[model samples]
Target: MVRIAHIADTHLGFRQYNLDEREHDLYNIIDEIAEKILEERVDIVIHSGDLFDSPRPPAQAYYAFKRFLAKISGRVKFFSVLGDHDTPKRRGMPPQKLFDDEIRVLGLTGGDHQVLRLNGRDVLVAGVSHFSRRYREILVEELKKLDVIAASHQVSVIALHQAVDRFFPFEEVFELRLDDLPRNFKYYAMGHLHARTRASFGKGELAYSGSTEIMRSDEISDWEKHGKGFYVVDLSGDKLDVREVNLEGVRPQLEVRIKYDAFDLELKKLVEFLKTYSGRKSPIAHIIVEGKEVDRQRVQQSLNKALLGKVLYFRSRIIEEPEKEFIELKPGDINISALLKEYLRDEKVAEFGYELFKVLKEGDVEEAKKIADEYFRRMMKIDSEKGVS
Candidate 1:
């Protein structure tokens, strides 16, 4: 049996507020991941990408990484590719070669491929990193020249850090398709998408390990909870099995939509649902109340007080019902906030810049940097705060 661990998007050193505390928590998560691998006794570990939240990780981040790598030395083989966030935007940024041989980093150059031998079977891994804004072929053409099928009789897996498919809005940013892959690999382990999923395309299995941590309120809201972790893959000869090892407990997620007339009754129902499900094993909770008649602040206050700190986030929207059908190109056709979102979605550059502007306008320099990072993240399609294709 060839046991392998697949993890992605660790996003170490992701400090939003309370730098010391957040940084500590971030490293703790990394420790948790490494611990899982050591306990399982996996033969090799593959980190799809996004090891660091920032391209130029803080000294603390590097120190933590080095320490963790030292702990796992000689016990398990580890491999990582450059994620969009891990690679600095400026040209001539240093490569992972600067790190000691104990840490093996792959895909620093535009086109790079790696092959590992596990129990005498060759596991071929190929990848492409975000070098710029323009979306180009994911180097599948170059990968085919390697002839993966002939290299191994035990089993073979391809590691890539690109979007799942082309239907996503940011597909134009990192466009990749299932058909573009080499036909003979047994599994295509992918990253850059923060959802746990498996798809059978061509002749292999395509899988995303998802983000190991929740980076945004939108992600928590969309996924509806927080129990982030990695995928453990077990390979026996030519067969493969995979499972998710969740570090955090399961948190309940609730979304309620009520009409203006039914506010009183629905509000009670929503609260009842929140209270009943909020007592789960998970430490985090997310509740979203959206409708035409929602009282955003009041709902937030009620929910916040009721759940206290257990509620990771609460979002409520107020939208008035339309009296008649909306006329095209007419005023008051769409809700104010809805209209703003629609307008912002079209202009990519301005939309990103404004996200940065929002933090600056609020006079939070550190926060402004975080949001600015997100802007570049959005443009790169690396942030799945929106959704997967």
Candidate 2:
């Protein structure tokens, strides 16, 4: 049987939250992926796209990828397509080209196909790199051409980095539709989205191996559900067999939502979760705190004191519920003093505002000045008591 390891979206060099550990986490995943692919005894490894996180990757990222290539160079053949991130914004060749001839990246800009003899059976791999939404028409034309070419091959496979409307996360924006794809390939290899998916397409299975590491916070759900890894596609059998291989080396990441009311309880749970992974790997925690009124400064202080050294890093997204400004403006319900008191907890300021409003409306400037002086005096006294200037 012809074995093909379908992987994509390695995203090397991505230092999430600007943490050095995050950058290495991606590199570590590459190492683990290499080991897994070799263990599976695959004949070919096809990275659908995004071999590197950037078109011009960091020096360390290049070295990490080189180490992976060293492991699988002679043992297995490697092929890939360019993801949007791996393509340059201006004029420049991708960083993977540095390993020229070692890695086969297909279709830099257009459709390209190659045939390989595996187990005495001809396996055809053809695809185009990621195309922006603007060049989608050209992308369609290229796929049609590749489809015509696939008609001539016995066991044909098409790899694409574009997101199809069928499986794309967004309902409105899409690069290619399912119908836009050619109807003849034996398997459809897709990339870009970091989610594991499989469907019956064309004459065979359509699948996405998903990203090797957790690239974004939103990907946590899929990463947890499917686990991070690649797919092993066996092509020699009558019915195509696609098996998922999850890696054990992926760094753990957590998304915790701490409500204001349950701050202590949730923080305790989060601390315990981190403790479980002690000496194993520090997990990345993305905390979201929600409440109507919260002291952001105090929240940070409490977290710092409780979760110190417990996690690799903790990023909190504080969302404050907006307070009601006015009571939908009514004629007799205009009690400005009550509204001020509700928001301005300082009773002195609220009283001063009420008195000043009455004096100013009556053109009593001296009385308004007197109320302001008294308000400032009270504020100074309170600030002094709190040890503030």
Candidate 3:
């Protein structure tokens, strides 16, 4: 009865909200997982991908992972693959090879297929790293080869860091379809998606271990609903028995959306929510206000006063509604460009607002700032010519 712990998307070194404590939380959670592994005496640990948040992790992150491996050395074997974040920008360079000889890293620079003879049983593991659209063809070719190798083994598991069809709601970054997967694999251990999920794939099962920490605000609701954890797969029998082992020390996150008119009421409610929070540690709060022309300063001050120390971090996003007065414009009565120019004049950036707007629309904020600087310089020149302060 081989017991394997499946964890993924650790994303160590991710400093969410630029908070160093958040990075520390990641390291602590990994230690907690290691402790659990020791308690269970698991046969192996399988990390799907994203061990680090970036290709070049900070020194602290590297040390944290090194310490984790050291804690579990000689007790359990670790098998891992590289996710998009772990892959180096330089071509043909493998990041996993930097690890100590005690660990085995795969799916980069070949060696994607491993056969472990444990307790007189052959456990086959096939891995594939993250691949972009430009390398989709290469990924397909590798999967075809892996399919042949998996077919020859009795117990085969496929590990990949790519989006599976229908598994995630949005597929804008999807790399492969469900049908692209090879058949007859006993289990499919997946990564890349932060939400925990499980689904049947022909005769086998597919599961995502989910990210260990809350990386984004959008993931807060799902994490609150499903909780965050890893999976323990009991592969002693013909059928896989997967059990979820919830982790402690996960930072709590909350999102409160309210209309502009109800800002005060919602603020009070948020205060009450914080007061009733049962988490051992402070949570992260995101307050989103929607309505016309909110007093951003006043609202932010109130939130801060009410939520001070109740959360590890507090941020507010105010979405101003489009002016109702401008919604009734008649077709062809007013030129769009002319109106924009007038608006820019009112905003006091008329000189370069048009250029800035064009660049901003393309999501180049830095270029937009450069245009604004040039406009400022031109204004300074005009002011000097007129001898004005």
Candidate 4:
């Protein structure tokens, strides 16, 4: 049976919370991932995309991946597609090109497909680099051509670094919808959406193997439940079977919510929980403080004292309910933009703020960047018209 390993969104060099430890954790995971892939004895390895967190990754990120490739270079075949983060904003070569001799990176220069003969059978490994939402037509055109090529192949797998609307709920940033994909490939190895997801599509299944480590606080719950990992696909059977291989040694992250009235009691419980994570690398904590009329200053001081040595670092968010006057409002049509404008007293600024809020709420970092750029451009144009130096 032909075995293929699928992994994506490693985001190497991402230093979450400005911690150097977090940056190196991504590199460490790559080593762990290689060790496991070797143990499984897979014939092929597929890194769907986002091999590095940025197009111009740090030098240490290059060295980390170099060591990883050194371990698996000749033993197995490795293929990767350039992710949105890995695609340069200007004319430049992709970072993966430096390791061209060690691996094949698809869709950057031209041909994104490679037909391989493994275990006396033909297997097609094809993928395209990321395409922004505005340039989706170009991506679709490429996929249409790939579909024709995939028609004759029985064991075919297609990878992409773009987010699909169906799997990725952010409409503003999702580049493609479910129907945008071709119905020919037997396995769809997708990336961009950090959450692991799988659905039966076309003749086989579409799956996102997810990121190797927790990149954000919100991803903590999913990571705890699914445990970060990769997948192994068996193509020699009547229908392909996928097996998930969860990685160990990932740094733990924790979250705790405390009500204002029971702060002391809840703090005690939280401290006990933090005490249990006695590892070389301490866990990161997200503390949520909730209640009406919450004293933000007191809570911050208390948390600092309690968490100083327990966690590597801790960040907190305070949630306060609207004023009692707001609670008495009649049930009627609610307009969030109108309310925001009322509070800001400037229609233009309110609109800009609302747009930013929407993108941040959806966790669409690309869209947030776009909105911020548009906001600044408009401001600069207005300033110029007003003769503001």
Candidate 5:
């Protein structure tokens, strides 16, 4: 019987909310996973994609990965593909060279398939790196080629870091439909999306191991539902037996929404919820207020004082209803700067927007343009550095 560990979207070196401790948290979780691998004594580890948060990972990030491999490299074989975040902006330069040959990093520059002989049985592994809408045809062609090769193998698996039509709503124009995949493969291991999912495809099963940690506020709900973990697949039988091994010590996260009229009641409820939390550590809370003309500052200050040290981070998201009953329009009644400030708060870009509005309102067009450019550049840099997006 072949035991394989399927993991993906580790996103190592991700410093969430610009917190250094969060960076350490990522490394800690990886170490735990490595220990689990040793305990399980799996034959192979298949990391679908996203080994590092960025293509050009920081020194600490690289060292963390190296340490992880050192723990289990010789005991077990590891295979991975390049995720969108792991792809370099500069063309023709693949990041696979950074690792030793002990690990087989595929789908970087060209190659897409590898065959491993285990326990007198042949296992074929195929993959494709992140690509845009323009390369859908190329991706389809490659899958067909892999399908032909898989026909001769005992077990065939395909790893990918792309959105599949069955998993998510049809929002992305470049998403891969279920029909695009070849029917011959035994299993499809997926990544990129941060949610645990499993769907049947033709004669095989397609599953996403999901991100190991929470990377964004929107993922909080998904994490709460499925938890964060990797998959354990036993391919010895005719039907695959897949199970999830949830990693322990993941920081908890909570999302709360309160109407303006029920602020006091909701505040009390939140306090009760925190006081009763039985997790190993305090959770990060995202409190969202929804209503018209609510005093966001007053509520936020109250929450901060009440929940101080009780939660790791207390974030406030205030969404106010637009005023639509204005009898007449005044010159400054619809101040663009004021509107921008409110919008920025919702978007969580208040700091940049504040500086931008200051320069634009001062009538310095050149300075405003520079500020705008610098703001976007900084945002992109942050996104790239933390693998957010």
Candidate 6:
């Protein structure tokens, strides 16, 4: 029997553009989650990928990761497969050993996948780390090679980082199809998609243990408020039981909507909203104000007081010119007058449309009414061949 903890996508050094103090706040939250793992006394910790937001994280991020490792050293064995973010050559060779050898971390790049004997049974741990985006599909090929070795009743688990088959729009990068994976493995532990999902494909259990921190807005809507956590896998012979371990002290996300014709009135209303809703320990706030010519600075400045004494992240956008031209249509710019021409001509608009739709929270409000109506109309017409109302 082997007890393993699976977590991924810490995304260290991620910049929090909206809030002044949000970056450090997220880092601290991750530390808390790691500490919880130590307290649980899991035998091994497996990070699927994306340890750093960049291939090279800033000094602060390095120190934070080091501190986290210090807390769990000797207590739990940590093994991780590098994601696209962990650049192997950028950091030089010696310090890389600090992650692999001294840290008791074992995975691809440091060592090839191997079979371990536990309780008189064999279990194979096969892994491949952060291949460059262009060549990440090598993972599928590597798995095929492993399938040549036949092991009867042995549980083979693959820790993979890349996206697969557009699990979500955001997860389309390392995109793979169900056919890409080998047919022999018993378990497939995956990352990069920030959702807890389970599926049976090719005689194996495919599971994704999402991120330990919530940094993206869409993660909230898609994950059903279940983004922050790790998974505990209890392995006994040929069967596996998985459970979620919630990290404590995470602030709940607050989506506040205040509408006014005047920007001044909107600012005043925002302050009042913050004052009434703010909490000391866990303050995750997303503020959206809709009006014409909204003074972004005034609203941000006024809410400063309300934001103090709490951990809050605020996002604001001004939609003053509602029907304003999104793009200029020129005679030379393809015939946008036609529906297909309009949709396919501007790929940028389509991408922007997806991004905007992800952030607009409320569906039953006047602010998002037009935006939602346009999105549904276009989507239905294109994908379903239904006319816009």
What is the model-wide C-alpha lDDT for candidate 3? 0.80
- Local accuracy of candidate 1 as per-residue lDDT tens digits, 12-123: 7777444455556668778878788898889878888888876677888888788778778999987777776677655655344456486566656644656677676666
Candidates sorted by lDDT, best first: 4, 2, 3, 5, 6, 1
**Candidate 1, position 55, lDDT:** 67
Q: Give the CA lDDT, 0 to 100, for residue 357 in model 1.
A: 54
C-alpha lDDT of residue 277 in model 2: 90
TM-score for each predicted model, relative to the true structure: 0.70, 0.81, 0.80, 0.86, 0.80, 0.70
Quickly count the clashes in candidate 6.
2
Q: Of the pair 1 and 5, which is ahead by TM-score?
A: 5
> Which 10 successive residues of model 1 have the least lDDT summed?
323-332
The candidate maximizing lDDT is 4
Candidate 2 residue lDDT tens string, 236-292: 876799999998878888898888888888888878778889887878888888787
For each candidate, the alpha-carbon lDDT, in order, equals 0.62, 0.84, 0.80, 0.87, 0.79, 0.63
What TM-score does prediction 6 earn? 0.70
Q: What is the number of residue pairs that collide in model 1? A: 1
lDDT of 3 by residue, 1-389 (tens): 78888899999888887799999999999998888888877888888899887777788888888888888998898988888777774565544566848677777754388899887899997888777645776888888888888888778787888877677433334678888877768888889889899988855789998998888887887787788879989877878899888887798888888888988887788788787765577988888888987998898888878888888898898877875455554434654345666876654555356555545643545556766777789889999999998
276-310 per-residue lDDT for model 5 (tens digits)? 66656778889888788899779878898889978
Decoy 2 TM-score against native = 0.81
Q: What is the overall TM-score of model 5 with all chains considered together?
A: 0.80
Residue 264, model 4: lDDT of 88
Residues 208-265, model 6: lDDT tens digits: 8887666666566644556568888876645677888876654456666667465456
lDDT of 1 at 94: 37
Q: Candidate 6 local accuracy as lDDT?
A: 0.63
